[model samples]
Target: MSTVKVNDATLERINELKEKLKISKTLILEIAVGNYHSKFFKKKEDP
Candidate 1:
């Protein structure tokens, strides 16, 4: 596990989502990172 520091606003949002979705903070971050990677990073086709 890694420790990350987040601003108050971000922490508030994360907590809101966690309560709304009934998921853990770690899963919230994981899903967010996955979405970010999918949106910003393209996968290269294998030759």
Candidate 2:
């Protein structure tokens, strides 16, 4: 639906991962975003 701009090297890495991992670019990006969110944004809640 929307777009984000990435550098040439980053795009190339993404393409390489897409082929090697046999996964869609969308999924690759989704996982990357999820990991990033967990690492930097989300806080661990104590039970």
Candidate 3:
């Protein structure tokens, strides 16, 4: 179990996207964090 604090603006945006996309907030965060991880943490291959 873990806890994270989100700012007001980001929280509001998440709520808006939740209603518009009709997805759970947990799913939204998961997608976002997964994307962020893939963007930054991907392994590089030597060419």
Candidate 4:
């Protein structure tokens, strides 16, 4: 259980995406955070 705060402009964009995707705001946040983490923090495996 956690919380995230965003500026008005970011919130508006998230709301618009949620409406366009027909999904919940929480889902949008989860996807965004997951993508960010994967892009920046995911570990690479050694061959």
Highest lDDT scorer: 2
Q: Lowest summed lDDT over 10 consecutive residues: which window, candidate 4?
A: 38-47
How do the residues 1-47 of candidate 1 rate in per-residue lDDT, one tens digit apiece? 76987899999998898797766766889999999888666654333
Question: Ranking by lDDT, best first?
Answer: 2, 3, 1, 4
lDDT of 2 by residue, 1-47 (tens): 65987899999999898797876766889999999888765465432
Tens digit per residue, CA lDDT, model 3, 1-47: 55888899999998898787765766899999999878676654323
Against the unseen true structure, what C-alpha lDDT does each candidate score?
A: 0.80, 0.81, 0.80, 0.79
TM-score-sorted candidate list, best first: 3, 4, 1, 2
Flag the better candidate by lDDT, 3 or 4.
3
The runs of at least 3 residues in candidate 3 whose Cα sits more than 4 Å from the true structure, single-residue gaps closed, are 1-23, 43-47
Q: Is candidate 2 or candidate 3 better by lDDT?
A: 2
Model 4 segments beyond 4 Å from truth? 1-23, 43-47
In terms of lDDT, model 1 sits at 0.80
| Backbone clash pairs in model 1 (N, Cα, C under 3 Å; residues 3+ apart or in different chains), count | 0
In model 2, which residue pairs have backbone atoms overlapping below 3 Å? none
| Residue range with the least summed lDDT across 10 consecutive positions in model 3 | 38-47
At residue 25, what lDDT does model 3 achieve?
Answer: 65
TM for candidate 1 is: 0.38
Say which prediction, candidate 1 or candidate 2, comes out ahead on lDDT.
2
- Model 4 clash pairs are none
